[model samples]
Target: MPWTPPLEADALTTLLSKVQQWTPFDGNALLDDVGAVLDDVVPPKEDLDVLAQRLRGHLMQLVNIAVTAEAGDKDPEADRLIRQAHTVRAEAMPDDHRRAVGHLRRLGWTVNELLERLVAANCLREAA
Candidate 1:
């Protein structure tokens, strides 16, 4: 299914809750952290189009990282791809997005692992 933009605070909250529930951390703590972060974000008007786009970019970066990591050591091309991904992430993310990205980065998760987990969470959320 195509991604749907979050229109209300409740919707975003629900998404956050769903994502947090699927996270590896203690469910309560993850939910609390997600709530704290959501409290800071200014709700997007009409749609979460910008946030969605930023997330898509982030996902693509993770894909690049996964491919590079799987290929072994950092060659010139891998280095260039990683650099490009970092640049895109820096340019696309806002403060809350940065925090979310930072939290994930600190988790010591590989790109493929993150992608798989996120996709599974999103799928489950949609199913629910």
Candidate 2:
């Protein structure tokens, strides 16, 4: 399983509720073109904070769609993908900018895979 941040009881409960209530038209799914999310995390801004936030937000987007689609009954692979995003988020990044960018890029690919899966499942319209 992909490692996720430890969830508090309340947060877990809320996620469960949202999952239970999700529909194909659910607002919880991330329908944005998230492809450029890390475009800024290049040479000038690969600092710890910048990369961390981007990573978190990226994972959140992946997780949101996966969970929502799972609820919609359109995808059973959601759980594994969600876990993979969690794993990427929990890993430590190197202090070197190049290494950091590489780490973030790995997660970026994971995010792209989730987006692709969502599209295949008919949960998201492909952005032009």
Candidate 3:
């Protein structure tokens, strides 16, 4: 079946073509902030909601960049990023603070990995 995107077809095509440059998404700062928060074995869950929201956005962008770069289907690393993005999207915010903390921490790790893979694929502005 042909699936429809939320965006209009022509608009989405143009936007995705530009996404190949992987700009407007700061992987360095994102890595730093996520690292700082997850540095502790158990980070406070108070900010999990905000962090998760940001991470979700970043993951989605990463997936789009991967697709634009022609990495999503054939490359193993991009495939991993796509799968992880799907996982996070399917997940819900954990009610228990501890679980929430754990989930965010894991997402932190995933984002870090995705950035590395993207850099290696020459998708980002600079090596991450």
TM-score winner: 3
Q: Over the full model, what C-alpha lDDT does candidate 1 score relative to the true structure?
A: 0.42
- Candidate 1 lDDT by residue in tens digits, 1-128: 99897899999999898778552323234333333334445334422344334344444545444454552143454444444445544453334645545433322122223444433434212111
- What overall lDDT, based on C-alpha atoms, would model 3 receive against the true structure? 0.75
- Give model 2's clash tally: 1
* TM per prediction: 0.26, 0.56, 0.73
Point out the higher-scoring one by lDDT: 2 or 3: 3
Q: Give the TM-score of candidate 2.
A: 0.56
In model 3, the runs with Cα more than 4 Å from the true position are 1-23
Residue pairs in collision within model 1: none
* True-vs-predicted CA distance for residue 106, candidate 3, Å: 1.8
Q: Could you tally the backbone clashes for each prediction?
A: 0, 1, 0
The C-alpha stretches of model 2 lying farther than 4 A from their native spots are: 1-42, 45-48, 71-77
Candidate 2 colliding pairs: 2-83
